[model samples]
Target: MALTVPRLLAARAEAEPAHIAISQGADTLDLAAWQARTQAIAAGLRAAGIRPGERVGLLYGPRDWIAYACSYTGVLAAGAVAVPMSVRSAPAELAYMLEHCDARALVYGPAAKPPDVPVELCWGPERISALPEAEPIPGPRPGDAAQILYTSGTTGRPKGVVAAHANLTHGARLNPPLRALAHSRHFLHAFPIGTNAAQTMLFNALTAHAGMLATARFVPEHFARLIERHAVGTVFVVPAMAIELLRSGALERHDVSSVALFGSTAAALPPTVAAELAAAMPHATLVNYYTSTEAAPTQTSMVFHPARPAALGRAAAGGTLRVCDEAGRPCPAGVVGEVWMRGAGIPRSYLDDPETTRHVFRGGWTRMGDVGYLDAAGYLFLVDREGDVIKSGADKVSTIAVEAALHEHPEIVQAAVLGLPDPVLGMTPVAVLVATRELRLAEVRAFLAARLAGHEQPSRIVHVDELPRNAGGKVVKHRLRELFDAAPDPRT
Candidate 1:
């Protein structure tokens, strides 16, 4: 049934040897070719003394996506846990992840800089390709550990999420497979390697009917041109990329009508941006995919409907969703609470932190760390991150709701709301904006007045060229707070 990734590759290679599995610009790999590379890499790892169940770090840049994909598969085939790391990560961060996972070896690509962390061995594309292809190694069970993915360290050091083979292959073996973008011959995305969103794209390449086409980096004009050039049927992006695509007028310049499905993931899509996307790709289904590194493969996806612009969508992918109170009891419809999800796949945990593991993954449900509410129809609407909620005087404000309101303003190109320490109010909501032109605080306040409650409105405003974002396109709120720290007190 191909329950594990290795088994899936073997099955697909045998079933459709000539089928194109993935491509990056001029580089393409058929199922058979990819399988051969995977086997050779696995043989090399075995020869390097990388044992089963040990962690092996994969360092690769965006342009080396194909090599990274094959290397990751090879690690699994050799029964070793794959640790995917991005070259974009800070050297210290990369070193920490490799050292934390106790990696046996590091496999790197030409464009990647291997971390200085001590490991038994390091192999690059040249050496990896030189290894003789051996027959497939055995003994990887579906229940065994598969990969370790690190979360963006917005608040603290990045934590590794350990996903088992079952988690990655959850729905791969269904009698009637559920293929994403089933109508498309090719799906295109510029997601950075090592992100949860990018991991999903990898799985789609292995299981979906379409070929996965990826760009080395995301340039709005280039992205749009690729869609038009290939007549791409399915597309994916984060909200930041979508914003750029619209702001750069790429949609107007390029013929992107070939795209039938447009998906956004990694963060909640602001209602304003979703509306703009719907307007630009009128025929395409605009979907928002909401999930975390901890609750992956189990997510909720919504097709953009003008009537329910804020809904994240009901649970999909054989998973269940609920909004629960502090004690973990389910909240009634429309009541804001912590969000949690339970998927058919095995529950993931923090790599080595049992205390945090107990706090986040409870009773088979992964706490999403975001505050949200479920509607009567079960659609979820995010309020704010648990840490980002603003406590102003006796009232609480949702940063997400405030940001959504700010995005609707015509002059605002980007907006991030965060709590700033206030002498009188303890903490107050502040708006950091990237605007088309200078806007008076009074004018911005008046604009948000009708959209937000008094307490939800920002007490002060700050202007920036752009909001600082992580690789996955999520705003780094702490960095925004740092900006306010360097400035004169707003209360003054």
Candidate 2:
């Protein structure tokens, strides 16, 4: 049978009726119960006037196990597209999304209130008394819009990237070696379900017959305790959480041997950080995927190859990747250019943003605005984001490359590099570092001198206890620039 999200759940319900399907601390639900709850929620959504092709926004906390799965399946079962909005989204931003998507209904939890929409439903652990188990709707075609994920809005206001059912399902079928070896029976997710990583995790788990463990937020101590308490086999984490787990010594204290697969996304995984995690959790395989929210996940590195830290592995299943110049022609191997992807798994367009959609989803190929190159062996090497490139004295330096170099130093725990306004150079690269131990600017400069060209080195280095990061592990460069502007100049 062709695999669809709801169909996968239904098959699991019959095949593994008694098997655990989801767990959160002390709470657990088997496949039978999970399917029933999802069906009931689907009926409720249909009753609430949700129709096929209409957008339904889900603004809820992470830990409500029943609601989380039911909400996702409910939208699909009702034949409506699910738009999972983060609980952390500002009210204005939420309002704009609701208006932009023309969302017909909203399902929210206690933490997030629905915007002024005609239909709103509140859900929690308590089962809805009136909801009935509804029949699953006919499976959607491959090209139907399955989800609309919002980007970080780094360049401008966020645009909703519309992903088709085929785009999501294709990735779901290709079982990565890490997940397969771990026998990932339980998926522990700390990231928000609204994001691409969370969505991918849920889809993959359901298809693999794995239970999902949800958490409201990431608290190092709490997360470690939960991992130990529940024999969670798979965990989806970000770089910030990985750094904290290493720094807090939580991994040493917790018995997380059941955690066999450790996957990271949304940011670059520094080689130093990956090494630390490998040392701490010798039983687990560390995997990192590099992709934008716009294109879904393009490439993934399931194993650490020290010689190729920048490679995002080969293209994911059903996808083709090409690094092309501004004219859309493929560049030579080892040369940097914008990454382009074409496949059944690529998104159709951006919701309600025709101009942006036309620019990105041009002629069936999704243009990922990241500048990167492919090696001779077919491994992808990401240089930096197109917008984040720093131009210094006729040279364009990748901020990510400089940050990755800084992170390799033993004393530096985390690093973020950004462009600073410079009169002499169009923009100069400045490194902001979070030090694990005492570090000096001179020592940092000397360390980079050997690894990087003179122009790629940062003109100034600042040490801070921590760098600002969003929930997805991406450095908020906008906030970093603001902080830099607010600081009193040491030169003065």
Highest-TM-score candidate: 1
- Give every collision pair in model 2: none
What's the CA error at residue 174 for candidate 2, in Å?
14
Q: Write the per-residue lDDT of candidate 2 for residues 274-295, one digit (tens) a residue.
A: 8878888889878887767776
Candidate lDDT (C-alpha), each: 0.89, 0.75
Candidate 1 residues lying further than 4 Å off, grouped into runs, are: 174-178, 489-491
Count of clashes, each model: 0, 0
Which residue segments of model 2 deviate by more than 4 Å?
Answer: 1-3, 116-129, 137-139, 171-182, 436-440, 463-465
- lDDT at position 351, candidate 1: 94
Residue-wise lDDT of candidate 1 within 42-76, one digit each (tens)?
88788789889999999889988889989999999
Any idea what lDDT model 1 has?
0.89
Instruction: Work out how many backbone clashes candidate 2 has.
Output: 0
Q: Estimate the TM-score of every prediction.
A: 0.97, 0.90
